[model samples]
Target: MTNPSTLPDFDHPPGTDLWVFAYGSLMWNPGFPFVEKREGLLRGYHRGFCIYSHQHRGTPERPGAVLGLDRGGACRGMVFRVEAAAVPDVLRYLWQREMAYRVYIPRRLRVRTDQGDVRALTFTADPAHSQYCGRLGLDGTASLIRQGVGQSGRNVDYLSSLIDHLAELGIEDQGLRELAARI
Candidate 1:
């Protein structure tokens, strides 16, 4: 559970090439410039409904379930390669977007793509953070997810979108399926 500010910018030269991993909303809405995209497999981390969304998907009074890259297992997600010219701006956009709640700890992980393995920037859960609700069981998770409605619309919609995107990529998440079914 590290703070993003303490780390370097992927240790790359200013305005250089970089890769970013997207497992949740980012996969559908990166909100940044990128030249290449691929379905990459990230090991040593698993996606879970660990974060409580207070704005994007729900309000403080009724937080929504959101995905977080937790320790152990693996996750199949999308990876984007930002060109050198777009690196700085993309990084800035990413930092602002993903770090709003400071609930995620960004890390550089090796993602296995069809082209090859790439060291991409990934946002993992900060277990020590206040927003970290961890595994709240399937029924409990579905409850929060169903009751949530915020600026981004319904929390159920977000889960549906994620499930759709994952399905399009031929990725199967049993936990996600059970949660989705419960909701």
Candidate 2:
């Protein structure tokens, strides 16, 4: 796993645009400015409860499960187009917010959308990280989410918010839906 600070800063040629793929909280709260957004499809990675949050959603005593883009299948998410001038600031914020613990790998991946294909900055799951929870079953996952709380508030709120946003996008995540129902 690479520390976000250790990674070189993101760079783009002048006039080149920046794009970001939002599969989780980012969809609801991007925390940055973007020129446009569209529904997008990313292949080879799907959202799953693969990370145990030790800061935002739960504590070390009883970790909460958070969504990560694990390998396989495909993910339907939002792609945000950012102006070139804002790339540096946006990348800095995203690095601090999503890469604080190096639980995710910062990558530029291709996403297909109604607007066409776009190369977007995306954070992918780092299975090697200590926080990785692997493939915990739904019931076990739900149980943890039910009881977990951290600086960000209740884990159930996180799950429910994601479910609501996915519903608004007309995207169905059966596992998450079932888990949300149980919660």
Query: Each model's TM-score, in the order given?
Result: 0.88, 0.88
| TM-score of candidate 1 against the unseen true structure | 0.88
The weakest ten consecutive residues by lDDT in model 1 span 1-10
| Candidate 2 overall lDDT versus native | 0.84
RMSD of each: 3.0, 2.8
- lDDT minimum window of 10 residues, candidate 2: 1-10
lDDT of 1 by residue, 17-98 (tens): 8899999878878898889999999999988888888887789999987889988899999999999898767777887778
lDDT of 2 at 122: 88
Best of the candidates, TM-score:
2
